[model samples]
Target: MKQLKDITVIGVALFAMFFGAGNLIFPPQLGVMSGASWMEAIMGFFTTDVSLSILAIVAVAKSGGSFYSFSSKVSPRFSIVMGIILMLILGPLLALPRTGAVSFEMGIIPLFPSIPQYVFTLVYFGMALLFVINPKGIIDKVAVYLTPLLLLALVSIIVKNMLMPDADFPLTKISNVYAYAFLEGYQTVDALGAVIFSGIILMGLKEKGYTDTSSQVKMMIKSGLVAFSIIGFVYGGLIYLGASGASSIPAGMSRTESFMALVERVFGQYGVWMVAVTVIFACFTTTVGLTTAVAEYFSELTNNKLTYRFNVITITLLSYLLANLGVEQIVLFSGPILGIVYPAILVLVILNLFDKYIHFKGIYSGVVGGTLCFSILMFICESFDSLLVVKDWLLSFPMTTFEMGWLIPAITGGLIASIIYKIKATRTI
Candidate 1:
């Protein structure tokens, strides 16, 4: 009974941590676009978002449950470089500011359009800073109390939508539904969150006396299953709701607007309050978590030269300024950056999972280097008008049609590095 209870708590906490602003906004948009093909689209989205996220937790558990340990298998220098980049992207650069923007747009603007974005963001981050600066039982309490309320609201929305009269799904706007949804899944950023937060979950398990690696991995995987099952249900329901309304919802509506319209359709005027409550609790909890995680990481990295309080203040201020950009623009800006970084992180997660079988250390460097280089090349070519021809030619490369052009380079790089390693070992012998 105690073991089951511990897994349930950790699973709920993990779900709370991952189910934030992006998780809420993206699925409905995918549904709107995919229409009758919503199932295929969601299957692709699940592959990258939920599946990779669960694998990330298992990988971290096997790697001894720390970002540094999980990443350092490639090399210590690579670990620090990768860690800083992950922190920045997950911190002030993209994810943290996004929370404030999402909360304001989804929670505030619909009801209180008079509230200036700058003003709301300032107050939002200010509140988040209070929780982060003096975190105590309140943070845990918020997760325990508010998370269930949020879940109830969401489940109610899903169930209500299901019980309502069905609408016809329009023809899918996308040609390759699966690939488009796979790429769209990058926007959620949960896989990245999973890598960072797995350590926290492992700590929770340790507190429950699951000390050994084998027990820890088993417990973590079970908890992860619990968290993602609920996430998958919510995502599928939201996508279906969006599909049902695709013909009625305006084509030019932003993601937030479309979601708001869906809620309104379900509950009439009362949805305004429901959305407000849902977005506030979801985005605000995420804001506090990201801010504290970023602050603690930098403070420790700098060996107290930059104190935790200093980092908190600086990060909150930066996020506030960026939050004023609003949710749509922040998401557009994040796409290219995530495009470059996500593939590399995915490669690392898969490699680390098979650490025992991989004899050649150079395989890590080769595979990750190949992935990063290919991703950067793709980003650069796509960004430049003059490089259109180059982009076209690169697209002809193997697996580019599937949006995974990095796979071939990654495999080739690993094989070459293994051969080189064997040659060097023979010479040394």
Candidate 2:
């Protein structure tokens, strides 16, 4: 019974941590664009946002609760590379800054139209820095109290909206709703966060006297399921609200504007205040939590060559600068970056999850390499529109039509490596 209680507590905290500002902001627009196919869109969104996140946690726990442990199967150097990339995505460059941006966009600007964007961002991160500097009990307190409040508020909005859906739904503009939704979920970057966050959960388990590897892994999986189930349901509800309300959404409104418009339509003026408060609280906690995680990870990874305080200060300042870039630009900058990193992280997580069954180290290295190269090539082709020849060549690959050109090469690389490993093993025997 006590064990169950602990798991519930941790699970809720994990949910709070993963369900950041992006999670709140992205789905409404996704639903609006997905239109009639919103249900299929939600499934694709769930695959990237929820399933990948949980699996990343499981993979880390199974590998003894560290990014290094799981990624080292590929190579020690590869592990370090993965750690650096994950930290950057979760830290100053993207996720951490996004907290302030989201809060400013959803919370502050709507309420205080005259306030300078940078002023709110500065105040937001300053407060977050204070919490992150100490970083011990702040997250726990927020999780225990703030997270539940946020969940309750979101559920209320969802329930109210669902009970009284808009009379006419809009037609979807997206032809490939499932693929578009899947890519949109990448904007959340929770899968990347999951790989880094597993350590935090595992350490908590160890401190709680659940030191056994199997016990930790089992508990982590359970906790992950608990967390992501809530996240997935919330995402679905938000998407439904967006889809139902799409008919009323003006064509020129930005994603955040669309969401705010949705809220106003559903629950009137009071609903806006309710959502603003919830989003600010949620974004603040998420910022503090992610900043602390990145500081701790990088500090330890550097063998204390850089102090935790230094890392915290550096990341906080960098995030503050980027936060002033405004929510839209920050979100735009994230796509190409995530596009390059996400596939590699997914390949690593999937490979690590099945490490025992697939005993060949070469398979790990080969698949990761293939995935990385192909994903980078695809990203470059997309980024440089002048690369028409490259784009044409890439488009000819299997699954390329789905923007999944990496699949065939990754599988082929793994199979070839596995065969080579088996041959070497047989000869040695």
TM-score of each: 0.92, 0.91
Candidate 2 lDDT by residue in tens digits, 1-429: 978976887777778777777788799889888888889989989877788898899888888887789888889998888788878878888888888888887887778889998888888888878876864554366567678788887898898888993446667888888888887775566788788777767756776779888899998888888888888889999999889888889888887788888888888988679779768877876786688788888888999898888999999999999999976788687757787787788888888888888867889988988888888887788878899899788788886654567888799888888888989999999
lDDT of 1 at 393: 77
Query: How does each model score on lDDT?
Result: 0.83, 0.82
Best model number under lDDT: 1
Residues 47-161 of candidate 1 have per-residue lDDT tens digits of: 8888889898888888888788888878999988888988888888888888898888789988899999999998999888887785344335445866797788889888898
Estimate candidate 2's RMSD in Å: 2.4
Q: Model 2, residue 182: displacement in angstroms?
A: 4.1
